[model samples]
Target: MSLAVALEVTPLPLRHPLPTPPPHHVGQPPTAFHNPWPSFHQHSWLDALLTSRRNRDFKPVPPRDQLVKIVRPEWGNGQDGLKATWIGHASFLIETPKQNNNEGGGRGVRILFDPVFSDRTSPVSWAGPKRYTPTPCTLAEVPEVDVVVISHDHYDHMDAETLQPLYERRKGKINFLVPLGNAVRLHGMGIAMEDVTQLDWWEGVQVTVPTAGSVKLTCTPSQHFSGRALWDRMSTLWSSWVLECVNTSTTATAPGPASPLRLFFSGDTGYRYVPSEATEDTVPVCPAFGEIGEEYRPFDLSLLPIGLYSPRHFMSPVHCTPEDAVCLHRDLRSKRSIGMHYGTVRGGISQYFEDVTEPPRRFREACETAGMVWGKELALLNVAETVVVRLDLPRLADLDLEHVRSSKHTKYFGIILDLFDASLKKTLERLRLNTNSFSATLCPSLSLLAQMRKSSAK
Candidate 1:
C-alpha cells in the first residue's frame, strides 16, 4: 500500500479505541497524544538552507531555575468558560473544561498545541532556530493529555523528538490527529501508526466526552505553502485548526450553546485572503468578496505569526509583515490574538538585516497604526505574555478605522481574478500575494520572492 493510504488507515485498535472520557473540552483534554508516523524520504539539507532565509542571531537563553515542582494538574475554576496558556510560538497548553469532579477524571484537560519540545526546528536537532525561551511547561509538569493535533509537517510546526518522548510517556492514554501526508514522517520516526488519525483539510475528528460533551476538531485552510525541503514544497498540506466545543446534547439543535470556544493555530502564512481585499472582479468563483466558497468566520481566539518577514523581497510570500499580521487579525475575525513565531526562534540566515533586532518592533507600530485591540487593555504583546479571552468584554474599537490602510487600496484587488481562477478550476495553485499586485512587466519576477521586505517591519 502507498504511504498515504497505509498511514491514513488506522488499525482496528485505534479505529475504535476504548472511549475513556476526555478530561477537558469546554468540558475535553487538554493528553499524552502523539503522532506515530514518520517519512522515510530524505530531505536535502543543502537545499533546505539555500531556500530558507531564517535569522540566526537569537540563541537559546538558559532556562530559569525558577523551581517548578512537578505535580498533577489541579482542576480549576468552572465550566461555561475556558483558559489557554501560551507556551511560546504556536504552542499553547489549553485548559479544557470539566463538568464536575464527579467524573472519574483529574484537573480538567490540558491539551498542548504544536508542542515542539525539540532544541531546534530542523531535521537535525541542533541546526535550526535556537529558541529564545525555554519551554515553560516541562513534560513532568504537563497535565495528562487526551488528544494531540498536528496541523502539518513543517519542522517548526511539528517535531519528532518531542512527540516521541510524549508517546512513550503517555502510551495508549493518548491519541493524535494529523494532516494526510504527515503520517509518513511519523512512521519513519518509528511511531506506531495504529493510534494516529489523519484528516484532509476541512475534515474533522470527534472526541466523545461523557459529561463535558464533544468537540469536533476541524482542520481549516490557511493561506500558506508547506514543505520541509525544496523537492516536496506543497507536496503535503498546511492548515489552521479550528477546535470547537459543544456543550449542548450531541443531537440537540440549540442547547443554549455557550459561545463555542475556539482557538485558531495559524501554522505559517502570509495573510492572503482578507474579506476586505477580496472583490468580485478579483475573486473568480465568488466575485462577491465576503462570499468566497467558505469564508470561515473569525475564531474566538487566535495565535498568529508576526515575524521572520524582514527584507520584503523574499519574505513577503512566505512570512507576513506586521501590518499584514494586523490585516490578518482583522481577516480571521479573531476576538483576541497573541503574537507568535516572532521572538520564539530566529535561525534562518536570510534573517540578517542591518537594523532589525529580535522581537521585531515594527509589529507594534503596525498594530498601533491599525488600531488593533487585544488583551485586558487591548494592546499588542511586546513579548511572550498571556491574555484571557472574554466574549462579553469591552474591546478597543477606538481606532481611526477611517484612516487605517484597509480604508485605502492595498492593491490586493488585482489578484482577485487569479485566486478565483485557482479556486474555481480546483487545480492546485500557489501564488505569492505581495503588496504589489504585480506589474505585467514584473509578473515573471513575482515567483522570485527573494525581494520581499526591503522597506519595513511595519
Candidate 2:
C-alpha cells in the first residue's frame, strides 16, 4: 500500500487544504494547509535586522541550576498519572502514568514534543537567534523516548541537530511522528522511513508502547504555515497532535472500558482571524479546534503556543496572541493549559518592537480577563520546571456507553441535531425548559453537550 494509505489518511473538511502557489514550485505539494487571508509575504529580512539591531530590552537572563529530574518510564500499569517538564520554548517531556502498579509493568510512556536543544534555531551555526536559556537537559539525558512528535518543519520545531544525537542515543528505536510532507526530511536526516509515521489532518494511528498497552495519536490541524527555508515556504504541512494513552487493553473484548488520558499539544497556531478584524464576510471560523473539542473534550492537559504575536497586521494571521491562546484553551475545553513557544528564541516581529516578556504578561492578563484563575485553570512553567498532575479517569461504563450510543446513532440522532442546531428556534427554546433533566441525561456521558445546549438556549 502507498504510504498515505498506510498512514490511514483522512482528508480535512477544508474547502482548500493546501496553498495554490505559483507554477514553478516543484517540491511543494498542494496538500499543504492554506490560510484563507491573503497570502503572506514575509517582511524584508534586511529591514527586520536593521530594526532589531540594537534593541535588547528585557532579554531574559539564563536560569540557575534548578533542574527537573528526568525519570525513565515504567510502563504497563493502570494507575493513571500525567507529568510535564518544560525544557524551553516548545520543547516538553510529557509522561503518561502507568496503568498497573506491578513491579515489572513499568511507569508509563514518555514523549518529546518540538524538542530543540541546539545553541541556535537556524541552519547556520554562527548566525541566527541564539538560545537565550540553556536546555534543561541534553537529548541523551531524556529517558527512552517512545515517541518524538514534530509539529512542523520550522528550524525551532524540527532541529536535526537534536534529532541526530537523540537517534544515536536511542539507537533509532524511537517512533517519529511528523507531518505528511516531512518524511523525506527525516529520511534525509538518517531516520528510517519505517520508524516514522507521517499523517495528515484528522488522521490517526495506534502504536503499542511495549508494556504500556496502546496510545492513540492523531495528527490534527494547526493554523500555521511551514517551510524551513524561504524558498520552500508552505511546502510542507504544520500540525497539532492529540496523544491519548490507555493503561488497559483497548480491544473490543477488553473486560472493562479503559480510562484514557489525553494530551493536546497545540504545536504552533494562530487564530484564523482576530475577532476585531473579522467582518460579516468572514465569520471568524477555526473549525478544527471546535471539532477537536467535540470529539475530545476535557483534555487532561494542553500545551498551547502563546507568543510570537506583535504588529498585529502581519503576525496575527500566523502567530497567536495571548488572547487568541486563551480562546483556544476554551475551544479545546482543556482542564489545564500551559503557555509555550516563547522566551527561548527571538525571531518573530515582536522582538523588534515589543519586549520579550510581553507575551507571558499578556497571557496572564488574558486569563484573568476571561475569569480563568492562573496556576489552576492554566499555568506557566519556567524552563526545566516539572509539574505532576494526577488525572481522574472517566468511568468504564461511560466509555462503553459512548461507544454503544455512537453505534446506535439513529435513536437520538434527530434530537441531538435539533438541540444543537442554531436554526431550530423552537427546539432550543424547549431545551431551556428542562435543563436539569437534559444535563442529567448527559451528565455521566457527554455533560458538555448539555452545557452547550443550555448556553445556546440562553
lDDT of 2 by residue, 135-209 (tens): 756666666676789999988899999887776666445678898789888988988887788886767777655
Identify the runs in model 2 with alpha carbons over 4 angstroms from their true place: 1-33, 36-80, 101-103, 249-255, 274-285, 392-458
Worst 10 residues of 2 by lDDT: 410-419
Query: Could you give me the TM-score of model 1 versus the true structure?
Result: 0.62
Q: What digit string (tens of lDDT, one per residue) describes model 1 on residues 74-125?
A: 2222322344555556666665444342144433344567878766888886
TM-score of model 2 (CA atoms) = 0.71
Residue 396's lDDT within candidate 2 is 37
Residue 126's C-alpha lDDT in candidate 2? 97
lDDT assessment of candidate 2: 0.63
Worst 10 residues of 1 by lDDT: 411-420
